[model samples]
Target: MKICVVGGGLSGLVSALELAGTHQVDLFERKPVPGGCLGSYRIGDYWIEEYYHHCFAGDAALLDLFDALQVADRLVWLRGSTGYYVDGTIHPLTTPTEILRYPHLTLMEKARLGLLTLRSRRFDVQALDGITAKDFILDNLGSGVYSSFFEPLLKSKFGDRAGEVSAAWLISRIAIRSDRGAGGERLGYLKGGFRHFVARLEEEATRRGASIVPDTPVEEIRREGDGWVVDGKSYDAVVSTLPPQVTADLAGLDIARIPYQAPPA
Candidate 1:
């Protein structure tokens, strides 16, 4: 089978590498380089991530992928601190003592917040799907804690439209968080930068007989007799991993029902 993969982000690159040996793979990337969000730019002396990302211990798939690429040894675990800016003060919020001493909430409110956090860690996210996060917090922790603490945090993180966020996101966040180790929290980063991993993936794909074309965008996609045509080039199968809006335009599909929010950059 001949497969044409559009986009060269992490997902597209991984998919291409996985299929290169079994099929004739052609990867088309509109950008000059791969890595997508994981891509980095050179700073004064070191490369920096364009966006913030920290891997949790439970990210087994990502860890395994890094190991398979022979870059596992480069992964580093770092402990960091967190602060809460409340009532004209930046309070350290890393430990239980800090939580208890937080002046933004009363003692009862703090206890309620603690219980809510514990419950959030254990609760099944699927069961809370139909409920919004704001509603769930208010119901479980009372309006006081919700309004005084979590609400402002959510707004700062997700913008003014934070109420539209799904409870499932919060549930997953808490669940992953509850698994953190005793020495504060640990996050992984590559030794040099993620570009090393990206280079390895591209090399492996090419060595396995895959063709990668950068700066080539698929302007259109249409169904032919049995395969699909991408900008008039025919292929047995087409895998599009672009944004939904771009995918809709390329496939000539309606975009009326899809709802998406842009993440803060």
Candidate 2:
């Protein structure tokens, strides 16, 4: 099978690598360089990613991939701190005492918030799918918690459309990050940067007979008989790893009214 994987990010490269042995793969990237959000810069003696990134202990596939790429030795465990800045003061809220000292939420409210965090893993998030996080906070935990606590978070994470963000997404996010320690959350990072992983993945995929085309964006796609036409080239199938809105625009589909498809924060 001939496959055209779009976006040439980690997902696209990995997908192409996984299929290259049995299929003809052509990976296309819009940017001059690949890695998508995982791009990096050379800082002093080493490289660092442009965006903040870390792996969780629960990320088995990522660990396996790192090991397979022979970059496992570079993976290091680090404590990721959580804190807030208020009135020019930085408050680290990792420990129990710091949380208790936070003047915004009362003891009861803080307890309830912790309970919500604990229950997130078991919560029927689908029930809150259509409900906004703002409404969910106001209804379940009351206005004090919403205005004092979650409001800033929602605003910072979702900006102007924070009120329209679904409760399910917030709950699922909390659940996924539930693993914690006394200092902070334990996160994995490569000693240099994740760009090494991207580089290795690209190398392996190309070595396996996949063609990676950088600086070539698939602006157009159409179904052509049994195959698909991406740009002006035809292939058996196309895999798009770009954001939903971008993908929709490429395919000439309208999703403007879809709130979930709103641009990332």
Best by TM-score: 2
Estimate candidate 2's alpha-carbon lDDT, on a 0 to 1 scale.
Answer: 0.85
The true-versus-predicted C-alpha distance at residue 108 of model 2, in Å, is 0.6
Best by lDDT: 2
**Model 2 ranges with Cα > 4 A deviation:** 43-45, 253-265
Query: lDDT at 260 for candidate 1?
Result: 66
* Per-candidate TM-score against the hidden true structure: 0.89, 0.90
Per-residue lDDT tens digits of candidate 1, residues 1-265? 9899998888888999999999999999887877677776777877776677667788899898888888888888877567888668899877677767888789998987777667776787888887888998888778888887778878988787789777888777877775544455566777887777888888888889889998887899888999988888889998888778878889887866445655433
Query: What's the CA RMSD of model 2 in angstroms?
Result: 2.4
Q: What local distance difference test score does each model get?
A: 0.81, 0.85
At residue 191, candidate 1 shows an lDDT of 82
Candidate 1: residue 46 lDDT (0-100): 75
